[model samples]
Target: MKGRFHEKAPDDIQVFFPNPESEDPMKDEVMWVTVIAHDAASGAFLGILLNAPRHLKDVQEGDNVVFHLPPDAPLPVAVGMGGERLGWPVTAADSLTETVVRGVRHYRQGRFGHNPPGIQACVGTLGHVLEPSPQDAPADLRALGHFVLARCLAEQYETERAIHHFEEVLRLTPEDEYARMGLLAELSVMVHTSPDELKSGTELDWQERYLKQMATALERIKNPHSLELLGVIFSEEEIKNAAESNPERERKLRRIGAGAFRYKVR
Candidate 1:
């Protein structure tokens, strides 16, 4: 059975679901929970899955154990569930977003303050799943998912799939410069690299197609940084001509080129 949705997993780690819920419906309802494990090193995603609880014969969806509080804080501490501090860690007022972001920042920065696998995983999984709706997904999560999926696809050497993911990110966040840049970057690779480069007789050379598509994407992007980079690939004369031919594109490409120069220098 599928598990709940998760926003963002930890950085530099992969999560694994080795102990999935038991299939015996008679023992317990199918309790399932997606545990976000870290990479021990950089703490990126290991994977996610349902974890079976101790002493619970049957597992219902979204049912599992949680050992709240840092492991080294001291022995005999109480644990909390669903935001209630029934046991330890000295409850304090803070938004769930703040809490999760804090932990993520810590792990990513490698400034973790004595976070054991238990505490890190506990808070990491907090608010892990956004409301079951497209609108409910947090912007940062959406962004991260796009980035992660792009990286994964790229790793598999699927340039077009990776570019599509980045393009989706641009669609979701028109104002996001990084996402825009990423989309253009990946698209450039896809169009510039011909299938012949990869192997002919299978498909049209993607690199060549990507080169052709770059012009259209550059025209649409607002960020100047991306525009300038595209110009590097497209040539200034080509860009100038395109801008002259289409006023709207001319304005957008100018801004993109200007913005690209502004940031690309750094």
Candidate 2:
């Protein structure tokens, strides 16, 4: 009755339900989960509610269910009456293994799409780093491994390493909007906005118009459709200010467009 639930989604979204007594916990109670899937291609989203133990209790073999949860979200366990399989790490391990093998195969075939499948490979490496898994990975995997690790670090607010990862990703895909925006967002967070950072415009109206245009570009890039293709042109300061001033609206816009948002310089 005291186990955790584990689910993994593509990109940086993973969820775990921890044992009640787990150390360094985030939440105490195992409540209902609401998953929102933002389209990696267009940022359009559709979400669903998941009922804890009860929902998964009926899962059968060969069920084509796409699980969604954070890497560290806690799970629940049921009693014997529910035909529960307790302490079974192999189920999760098998899922992890398949993802890695598939990722490597795709990477070798140059079919890694645009992102190089770091999120999947990172999940495997994360398992090895966290547990004593017997995954025989190679040295070259380190490059992609480091990329995902850096993204994880960034999501956790580790500014320095995230920036480093963005740089590396940009090296591989020069026109990558995500990496470029990430770098700009982080820089905006660390560095103060200078008047010189603004474009050369003697008139006040011209400066305002320029800032608004930059802000509009930032909003457009938040859409995954625009992001993955040509990245929008904008000043980071204007984007940061817009994001900060309209936090709620911006978040809703981000969920609709994809998961892109300019991190406020807070």
Candidate 3:
């Protein structure tokens, strides 16, 4: 699945339905779905079951099911339904930038509340751009996509996944302060802090590699929250040295809250 698999006007998907006929209480029947259209009010997709029910009784082929989009999205391309399906040329679509914005919109909408539905849509839409192997996509959109995905993952404590996405954004723009800050913070976790990131044998811990630029990056952002994050890993002296003589920087650094990593540099 290197590129978009569902470009055809009518996309088909596979979803899990319980197999009522199976003796086991937990067996799931794989069903093929025909996506009809987006339902605006509920944020759920309306699809028709293409398979005749084998384990289901109340519904049969052509029955409708309103489903939440799965987290890994672009609606998985499904088979088993006999028909001539079309594929949209990978290059023919030109709304990628706008699509990225749409993803951000969804992310913001779902970023709050105990349960957020929009996050699913956010991941799916941005994931569409990602599968096309984002290397050739617009840099801003690509970085934005990775950044948003990274934030979503980090909040859930999916540390490694979040690190990978944050790295993606930094790769496109090494000067990305926010992404670097994010990557550094994530790498500070107990597992990664003790090991060198295995790439290129740099012999530099991921935290240190990012920290080499910390002062400059912090200067750029000038947000006190950044000082709070760095305070947890770097020693107070190291932070002060990095802050240099800028009166405001010193002021911010002094206000950094207390906390330190297991490997906090003294």
The TM-scores, one per candidate, come to: 0.34, 0.30, 0.43
Q: Considering TM-score, which of the candidate structures 1 and 3 is the better prediction for this target? A: 3
Cα distance off (Å), candidate 3, residue 29: 48
Please give the CA lDDT of all the candidate structures.
Answer: 0.41, 0.39, 0.56
Best by TM-score: 3
Question: Predicted candidate 2: what Cα RMSD to the true structure?
Answer: 15.9
Candidate 3 lDDT trough over 10 residues, lowest sum? 257-266
Output the lDDT of residue 5, model 1.
35
lDDT of 3 by residue, 1-266 (tens): 23322456336666666444466855546677767666578566666666775656544564455555545765442222222112111333357655655665565556432335666676677766674445666676678778877766665556677678888888787777778777766655522333353443232444355455455556665557666656554567765675777777555445431222221110
Best by lDDT: 3
| Candidate 3 global TM-score | 0.43
Which lDDT tens digits does candidate 2 get at residues 174-230?
Answer: 555555565655443333234354333333443343344335446645657544332
The alpha-carbon root-mean-square deviation between model 3 and the true structure, to one decimal in Å, is 15.4
RMSD of each: 16.2, 15.9, 15.4
